[model samples]
Target: MSVWLENAIARANSTSDWLSPIRSVSLAALKDTPWPTRKTEAWRYTSLKSLERATLSPSPSVNQDTPEQIDGFESFNLVFRNGEFDLDSLTQPLPAGLMISYLPTASEEMKQASLDEFSQIKPGRHLFGLINDVLAQHVVRIEVAEGVSISQAIRITSLIGLNSESHTRVFVKLNKGASLTVSEHYQGNVESLNTGFVEYDICAEAKLEHYRFALQTDKAISLGGCHFKLGERADLNSTLVGFGSDLSRVDTDIIYDGEFATAKLNAFYLLDGKELFDLHATVEHAVPNCTTLENVRGIVADRAKAVFNGRIHIHRHAQKTLAELNNRNLLLSDKAEINTKPELEIYADDVRCAHGATVAEIDKHALYYLESRGISRSKAQVMLNFGFINELIDQMPNQVLAEWIRPQIRNRFAEMEVTR
Candidate 1:
């Protein structure tokens, strides 16, 4: 093992008291799994050779503070820094029938029960997830009791400072017939990086709406994975909006274990400069009459690179399954790059499944037409780019989040002129 890995394992063993048995098992998985390389089929587009080549030391704790102004809608908030939960900053008197607490603060029985379910998940298959499993110090837990529907959204903000590495684990559970909206916001200093894993379970007839907004610094790197399981008649809707970073990757995996479940996944990303962003997702339909739809779009500018890999699987017993996947990319510069693959694996002939992928440069004819109409080239380009991504962003159920993301898209396009 590399020195960094060895040191991380030693630290994990020393601090095992603070970790659950399942977390300990995750550490073992990390030790066995090798770092990803070009040889790996799934990682061919994302070369982790540079990350393996560098020696990364453990980050030192610095002045941890949150901005006074969040510049957005008000809601119940949970903030964390450097993998440590800040209880003082959290909102008081959580919604009725809802519980939010740090894992380490829970009783031994509750912690162990949660760990039992958590440990069963396999993290060794993904190198970044394994890293998070070993290094995370705190785990955030959110539980919604049966028949409770939270009127207000719950927001989780993860902030990182310069030269620091933060790892975190999150678990969200919705009891039978419960409903909730959860939003995760990730922001970091120019020189900081973070890696983490999130696990979620939806009980029978429960509903979960999840949104992730990743606005990271130009020099930071982030790696994260989310695993979800849906029960009978459960519903899930997920949307991800990301602006590129030096290096960033988000992986999502969802499994339908019971009949009549439904899921929708939508994502939009804007990449510029030398930034690299990737999104990988898999949806598995194991029972009959499940439905899934996935759509992802990217706007690449300058020399930045982006990738999308989506897969939908239908089991032999999953008759009457309906699934569709599509990915589209708009390249603005000659040097910009995008790689997309849509895959479908079906075992039931009665299922309906389709996938499509496309990558293309901006339409010069459209730009010329706009220029002939006396519009500036830059303004025309922004208009076309906005038109490319707005379709997916408009699907967000939260108008507040949609409005907050619009300016980000425009500002990113404005900054691209300098970098290009």
Candidate 2:
């Protein structure tokens, strides 16, 4: 590690508590691991040198005047200033059958148990996750009781302040027959770094729809990961929308802990103005009679670049498992670039699994047809781009949320900025 990184680690350790086992694990992991490069299989297309050289600092306090409604859409909001939970702003009573508790405020028993839980996940294999675990000062834990179905979505917003590095861990649990939807929005204007880790533990017959929006300024960088474990007959639906970040990446892992579980991973990303994005998703079918569908679509304009890697693993015992993975991208400019890879590792003879990836420019023939109908070329391009991602946007559960994101997508394509 460089001197700067060593100093940053020291600063993180100083403010962090003497949490059991996590401190030792993190320090050792950081020492043994070097910054990722193109040689790393998982990061072959993305570089982390910008993030490694960052001067990390704890977030300073800022005003808490959060918006009650954004774009005329409202939901139950849990705002986090920097990486710490906003206790003062989140004083309202939680909805029925739902509970929100902060890890720093957790009881002794719960704190110790969190260590055990962290060990089980073993996030140390990934360098960023290890760093977050070792230095995380704030963690939010949400739980839904059995047989409870929440009507309103729970939204968590993490706002970065100034030149700061925010590390956070979030845990969510749903008991048998419970269902809920959770949305995570990361927005900021400062030149900062945000590292977060989230875990979802779903019991039998539970359902969860997890949505994420990363709409940071081009000066910010974001590194995050999510892990999901599903019990028998449980289901998980995840949708992600990303835009306007200097560098952003989300690594996700989904595992089936019991038979008959299902998972759907859908994402759409829009990048322009030299922005960058990377998404790595993995699904493991360890039990029989499970199903999975992974689909991602992206549009790259200007000089921006993006990467997508989707992998599905079917174990020997996971008979009758059905899984499909696909990645499609549209490049609007000659300078824009995308690297997409889809892989399937199946060990069961009785399973059907498939994966495919495609990258292409807008269809010329279709564009000509629209242009011939008196439509301007610029308007036609915007219409076609919207049609490309409309399927994924339609998958969103709420119309208000979809409408809120539509303008972001529309504005990106309508601008049609291309560099000579």
Candidate whose lDDT is highest: 2
Instruction: Look at candidate 1 and tell me the lDDT of residue 15.
Output: 72
Tens digits of per-residue lDDT, candidate 2, 1-420, equal: 656567757875676563636777777778888867788888898887667666556746663546336654545787777787787645877778998877677798887777666635424567778778777777777889999998777888887877777777788889999998988888875678888788889899999989888777577889888889999999999998887577788888888999999999899888887888999888888899999998899989888899998889899999999999989998888999898888899999998888888888888899889999999988888999999999999988777888888887888789765332
Residues 103-167, candidate 1: write the lDDT tens digits: 77779888777766663443357777777776777788889999899977778888877666778
lDDT of all predictions:
0.79, 0.81
Each prediction's Cα RMSD?
2.1, 2.1
What are the runs in model 1 whose C-alpha is more than 4 Å off?
18-20, 53-59, 67-72, 119-124, 417-420
Q: 115 in model 1: Cα distance from truth in Å? A: 1.1
User: Over the full model, what C-alpha lDDT does candidate 2 score relative to the true structure?
Assistant: 0.81
Deviation in angstroms for 377 in model 2?
2.1
